[model samples]
Target: MSEWQQRSLASLGNYENGFAFNELHWSEHGLPIIRIAQITGSQGIVDCFPGVLPESYRIDEGDLIFSWSGTLAVVRWSGGPAWLNQHLFKVVPAAGIDRSFLFHVLQASVAEMGKRTHGSTMKHIKRGELREFSVEIPGNECEQRKIAQVLDTLDTAIRETEALIDKLKAVKQGLLHNLLTRGIDPNGQLRPPQSETPQLYKESPLGWIPREWSYGSLGTWLMGKPKNGYSPQEAGEWTGVQMLGLGCLTKEGFFGAQLKLAPAGDRGLEKALLNDGDLLISRANTRDLVGVVGVYRDIGTPCTYPDLMMRLMPSEETSAEFLQLVLQSSKVRRQIQGSASGTSESMVKISSAIVTGLKVAIPKPDEQSVILCRSKALDAQLQSELQELEVLRAIKAGLMDDLLTGRVRVTPLLKSLQQTAAQTGA
Candidate 1:
């Protein structure tokens, strides 16, 4: 701890707030202006400034950006050169501080600065409050660089893993589309598309499908009648019963994390109780998310679902896995969206009749099993990458705590690296 020095954020960098450009200043041409919404890198440049702006207001690649208001975040600009909008600060590292290290330091301080935020409606950290936030830094610049390098390496790995996950998702989507439309052959291979082999295809209500496939309403695949879930009032404490939130079901499948507690005195939820491998679908949601289906996996707690969702019991003839895959298909999604009813575009409801009437191209039970196995294989790869991402994130968080606070020294690690390099050179 003696090797580290305590310093305020203000002394570590130049925090320059951006210009407040109005609609009048915006143009369709010229450089894009980055706003708080673009901080996460998900949204693209919406507005632009045609005229030349001051260099201080412009951010190039690798510039540190901090959003001081509503949903505070710190990021190194990798979205190319752009103008920084107001409520965001373009941070520059002080002489002794490493730029990467400073980025990490600010990233770590977001939570503490959030605590000092003022205003009720739009919470924000004042310049004075932001300047007062303190961090511990190593006295030696080399050590700081080394620590930043280690974290940056981890960041690269995390980003790569995330990219892999995204690619897997896309691949899985394509695979599902192919498998659901063209049934697998007895030789355990995906049959070619109708365009390549029309002789093996047949025209169905849903469109061109494999000759062995038959078009039927989803109701034909169900054992028990479709049932809506029960919704209970919010309980302030644990009630021994949990209710699945609408978020529990996603296009990707069931996400068990979004469960809420059922009211303590609530009853008559027995019919709504969810069991393992139960297929659930959103009865009411946005147009895009409505009718999304997922198979529930038990969370080892007494759980019931909300009224916004419905549960389907697959009959002996249907594979719940195969049915779930079919429901997520683009054709079925479009049908669901078309049949959904609501006054607002933000929310829509689907009746059980709509669910039952939607037609699907079904293959034999054996083909369904084969298709499911392929889907599960992709799912297994995706899950592995997702788990790796979580572990990498955890490791990065631990490294930030240890390295930034001087609890873990990077000097020893650096020395070991130098020795290995020297040996390699020899």
Candidate 2:
């Protein structure tokens, strides 16, 4: 630890929960009410609630707000007056303490606070507990300002890199949608069939596909579900068998990083061992998330799926990657949501029967191969961009830890902070 002073969070600021605003008082236009959902970052706010509030409920510029539920983070003012709701805690820093510095301290301690949270269901932070939390503050105001400036700069960089990555991904998704739905020929023209032959496009179980295409369900092609059934035991690193759960599947596709290793056991469902090119579809989840699909490119070791996921291995005619994309499309997602069954709002589940009945469009083998190759290339490019974004994010997180903790000095940036303050004052 650096040579610094320590103080409870209460010493620096008073924490007070916002008042409950009635639904009847809300209107489309008026003072934007700030809620826990709106306080997402250290500085300023985005996605404000479009509700009017009494003038007395307004929070002034530069006041900090922290979320009281789910995720906790300090909210900075963007030079505007706003009203706060019950799920937020406003922290008014005492004179002489930099609000930005306090925000950074609270953010850096979020991980520790999360671990300390106690609850069987929804975890939360009590005001008394938060007030007692201690933080190491720099010896002087100059030091505090320097630290906040450095961390803020790194955060800005990370945000910019993330934005770039998102734009690139959007571009790639657009390409995939176009390439798969309307293929490109050697001449770079859409491979639409001749206009004279309207029958060239025929209705299949999955909707209209090329006339010569076939329609089939995933069950028709898969060898069978993975043999090993679901395991309740926590996974270990050295365990030879790897088990893929719902976490491994992302909205875009399979995220290899989410795989966990399972210890060998006689969990009867072992027969469903996964292989390269195998497709996994989420079988149980929210209406929109259920039936999400991903193609397995590599399984480092033998892996089995939980009962909540369905394994799909296409027969000779269809490409696994092609089917994976088809399953992930908006049209297929709607079909899955429409087919789901459940009584409770939170218990929607898609059964194997529903999955087997899902209709898929299949093109000729050669065209399937073309579509698969193009998609894989685009996926590779997207993965590269995502990796780069992850690296930038890691750097920013590390910088935040060091800067906020006072382990790294930012004296060199003092002039920048002063200049920023001066410009804003002017």
Candidate 3:
């Protein structure tokens, strides 16, 4: 019948709890201490100690480790050699199971373990409960390895794709900083830095910019007094008018494709309906995200923003696209954040006075169009890459459920891969 046998996790591996290195023992540069946050995220080590601990408590790259409390996560310690701190379990295979197989099994159990965790605020997994967690593995070591190989390949791919996405985001940030400061020339090359092209750049209230680009206060570009939105009155199923929230805006730009329809005959419902080329700024939010900005690309149906946000209509002197970029740029973001006032950490707000009076560096309409077009192209690339990342994560999540749970076995797929490799001389 089935070659697989159910085994308690304790039988497959010996577990060692991490040493409780107190906060007093921390250091800047010494033996890196692996804490709970590190085990879950497990990025490069930070909190370190100068001294050494028992050899059993130490861990290095490729070691299988788990955080037993706070957050339950099984990780292969690849963040470099470090000392394992408290609330963690360093798993060492006893004899019967493959190391990678044990990690994959535990990784699959994280969700269940999280559910069963004790503590109302800070949950923890009991040692006995962790030791008793079970998984079925084929008795044959070859099959065990094949299964681990399949899961490990997906893990590797997911990690690499995540790293790539991070790099793409960093690149996009740099592109925005450079392009927004130095507008693209008609030749398509970026204008020289301020240091190199002093004549082309002139000092302004905002900063140095192309001499042709003159100072323009946000007021000059404003069509009228900034209008705050009307909040929906508990309109769960009401479908008369869609009401936009701060959530509709993202740093990547407007996700206005979806907005909750507001309650009927709401105050300011008529005036709040978003017009073409309206720039909405978050009048209130967290300190960092207080001035989050985006343009209403185009809403085909009836749409209006909520009280949490304000709409700024631009004049002929400025393009909505250009104003949107300026508002999102670091130069303007600093002003927005500095102007925001909040009583509590949970909520912060900026007044329309601060927004309308904020200074902005404006370019000739044609030059602004050039900068807008180029940034749009870069933004399109970023969005496409982001979509691919989403798909990869979804695929990985599905594979983990099926393959790890034995719903979809890898033995046959492994054999097929081996055969294809042999045929292709790979």
Candidate 4:
């Protein structure tokens, strides 16, 4: 066990505000700059060549930065070396402290400060608030080092897991192209390309596809007519029933959306009750996300959708998974985009007329079942990785809350816990 000392952050180092370089200094070439946007995780950066301002404005990878206004976050800059813009505080740690440990402490502090922030229009913490914010540090630097290392290990795992998910998604994207185009032959392997089996492939309005596969509008696959859902004012009370928003549509399929509870005994309600296996598409969203399709998984509670989305109850013969995969394919997405993709601040709405008429090449009923099984396998892989990522994130949050806040001691159990954590992840 080790004793901890309390100290104000201001005593540790200078809280230098990022340089407020003029627009004239901005350039296309030279050091990319970190603005408040960059600090809040927007990748866009403004480039400023050297000599634009004094040397004190630059920040390196791993340097701790705090965005004090608008949005609050503590980030260890991992991007290329860049200039620190205004409205940000770059803490240059003083001697006798580890930067990694200080980073975790500062992150916890910013989050706590954000909760206590005061403002009507825009919440912000005065410099005095941050200056006097107290922090606890182990008297033994070695213990602080171990705790940071442990947390960093968890952070690294989280990043790697996310990276793996991204890689799997890339693979899935490629898989989708092949699965939808060539499809699984009776042998359960990807069918040969058009070049290998020209007899099996033919040219259509949508391009080359398996000869046995048929092309038709999405409307044909629906068991019942496609219809838009009802949108109404959010339920006046929290205790009312749930209504769905466009936010419910996920790339994987229907995940839950913002829970909008309707007022008790509200009108215009009965027709909109969402049923299990209902395929949903967003009629209005950002350009990139417009026409995103998903299947609704009934959450065991009655739910209804809004007018910004379309629900297509698939035909009895059609596999919901197969239809969703087709809608998500790149070619079909391009058609959806062609109909309504635009550069507008207002939401770009995809009309049911355009979406329902989307052309797709579909396999027979038996083949769709096989494709569904294969697609589910891919989804299972991605979902498994995502689940692990969620668990690692939970573990890291617990560590930061406990270890950084001094509620849980990591010193005595450090090595044993480290070994256990090592066994569990990459």
Best by TM-score: 1
Instruction: State residue 388's C-alpha deviation in candidate 4, in Å.
Output: 1.2
TM-score of 1: 0.92
lDDT (tens digit, per residue) of candidate 1 on 1-426: 887898999899998999999999998988899999899876878999888878999999999999988778999999888899999999999998999999999999987777778888888877777557888899789888999998998899999999999999999989999999887999999998899999999998988999988788999899866899998787889978899999999999999989898887666788898888889999999999999999999898999988999999888877777889999999999999999999997999999999999998889899999999999999999999999999999999998999899887888866786899899999
Model 1 per-residue lDDT at 169: 94
Deviating ranges (above 4 Å) for candidate 4: 37-41, 44-53, 116-124, 195-197, 236-240, 341-344, 418-426
TM-score of each: 0.92, 0.79, 0.89, 0.89
lDDT of 2 by residue, 142-245 (tens): 77776777777766777787787788778777776665555555554555643544565676665556665666765565555422237556565566877787
Count of clashes, each model: 0, 11, 0, 4
lDDT of 4 by residue, 241-336 (tens): 688777788666778856688656756777888888878889888777888988888876778888888888777667666789999999998888
| Candidate 4, lDDT over the whole model | 0.81
Which numbered prediction scores highest in lDDT against the true structure?
Answer: 1
* Segments of candidate 3 deviating more than 4 angstroms: 40-46, 238-242, 256-261, 264-268, 275-277, 297-302, 415-426
Q: Please list the Cα RMSD from the true structure of every candidate, rounded to 1 decimal place.
A: 2.6, 5.9, 2.9, 3.1
Error of 3 at 252 (Å): 2.6
Cα error of candidate 4 at position 383, Å: 1.1
List lDDT for all candidates, in order: 0.90, 0.71, 0.81, 0.81
Can you write out model 3's per-residue Cα lDDT over 85-114, one digit (the tens) per residue?
Answer: 878889998786789988887888889888
